[model samples]
Target: MKQTRKPPLAVVQISRAVTVIRFHVCLLFVFFASTILATLPSNVLFTSTAGSAVRMPINIIANQSFGYFTKPPQSDQIGLYVRDGDGRISDAMITPQSKYQNFLGVSRRQRTQGPEYAMIARLVGSWTDCNRGAESCVEDGFRLSAFEIKTPSPMPTICGDALITSETPTKWAYRDLVDYQYIVVAMAHVKVDCDSGVFAPDIQTRADGGE
Candidate 1:
């Protein structure tokens, strides 16, 4: 007796169907996971870029605290300075009209409109804008304080967690994360000028990112 063989077309079609099903199953799994993550609290979802289980609920408390302590908003000129871990300092002049001032109430100085002013504004805004403001100064918009931004070092943190060391060596701690590259200390110093008008030294400490 002769045995019957399966058709080549049938075999090929079956194989293709299996592969397609697998691909779709994987896609669905990923989609469902991402949706669950989106529903979770920011702190929990943010714990690990990929992990699903979270311990803390994400909240705006930290940001709210910053806004509370920062000086009240006002209109004026702003000075920005940046110092790298290498100790190099760069400066930018900003006023209520400059397009690139990142902090609140900063923009092109009204009388000093020019390409340089535009360039400086762009640079400072790109670095940080914790103070909050739109690009380029607009009507009724207050300017950032020059004293708040003119320094190379970050603003000092008088409170919050402190950095300490121990005589006996111990495992690195999550608390020690304050030294993480992205974490920075910044100080805002504001000054009023009759010529340049009011400005602030906004100090920023940038993240090294270990790159």
Candidate 2:
């Protein structure tokens, strides 16, 4: 076979120019794509699980004290905080519109509308409005995010059993979970703004998840 000859210098130059053009085109495309992404509405919904158990066994005292303080929560269960929340609220209707001016989130100066921190309770079932403006007559809600032990297999405990076991940590905790519910045993400082909120994950709340 005859030996192959190299392309002419002009041909090589043209080839190099074509390659440079293609590279620039690609770079421009990436730049445009990134710019578009930045312009689009960004959703910052945060979700996470600590992969721990909630095992605070309550004695059968019918909500009666065991005459002794419950043991301090385990290391994994304590000092939980919601991450990434500035904990600011604005232009929201807070109940107890009374001395409510003194509420944490309410601005004493502004009185009604101010940077407020709200306590949002999650109810078990569909919540309905109560008559006579009764705030206490609403559906059963939780102050703390009730959590049960996370298990690989279905762990069943007696519904009638007043004693909380490692399997079922709460008196009635068999309901499906929802957003912002802390599944671990730790205490989390939930962070949010007036618009929306999420639990800042990977951080616990000794310092309100760094507030």
Candidate 3:
């Protein structure tokens, strides 16, 4: 009988090396993909008191104003607002409140009577419709349940001019310098959903902080 010939040792070694390289490349891709998803807005299913699951929209405000101002000037007071699609501003309330409220209070105290400082925040909330024939009607009302805040560097264009100027005091509107919503949609490489009014981020750009 004829003896079977074996492949060269060098060729086998090269094949093993190639397989190992492919495995590592796959692992790297998975790691990066997961990282990006973590940074992007996740669709968290939040249940309302009525036992219905509601998907709240997570909005990124690149540069806006926040304050803890009240009539009595309480040390633990905080308030934030965001503009909705209808051009109406709504309250963006934070949960587990005291910690964040105190932070804002301290921040305000440190810069008392100075220019309003800018902030970047990611807010997760839902909008509630106003009741018909109510005593007071607020259009396009939103209530935020969760939020993350960061101080912006190289503030946005709208922030350049102080919200409250000596010439025209009593202004406390929160505005953005750029079209942040548009920017976020573009960065995510996703188009705006006209029906849902949501900007969905793609997997690759999800992890980016968008700073």
**Steric overlap count per candidate:** 41, 10, 3
TM-score of structure candidate 3: 0.22
Question: Can you list the residue pairs that collide in candidate 3?
Answer: 36-207, 40-206, 158-177
Residue-by-residue lDDT tens digits, candidate 3, 81-169: 44445655443333222446548454433332121221221111222233221112222122211122122322221111011101111
Q: Model 2: residues >4 Å from true position, as ranges?
A: 43-211
Candidate 1, residue 117: how far the Cα is off, in Å:
69
lDDT of 2 by residue, 105-210 (tens): 4544433221121112121112222221111211111122332211111211111101110111222243354322223321212222222123322222221111
- Candidate 1 structure quality by residue, lDDT tens digits, 111-189: 3523423322333333222322211211011222222223221222111111110011212464364322121122232
Per-prediction TM-score to the true structure, in the order listed: 0.19, 0.21, 0.22
- Model 2 residue 113 lDDT score: 22
CA-RMSD of model 2: 23.6
Query: Judged by lDDT, which candidate is best?
Result: 1
What's the C-alpha lDDT at position 95 in model 2?
A: 30
Worst lDDT 10-window in candidate 2: 159-168
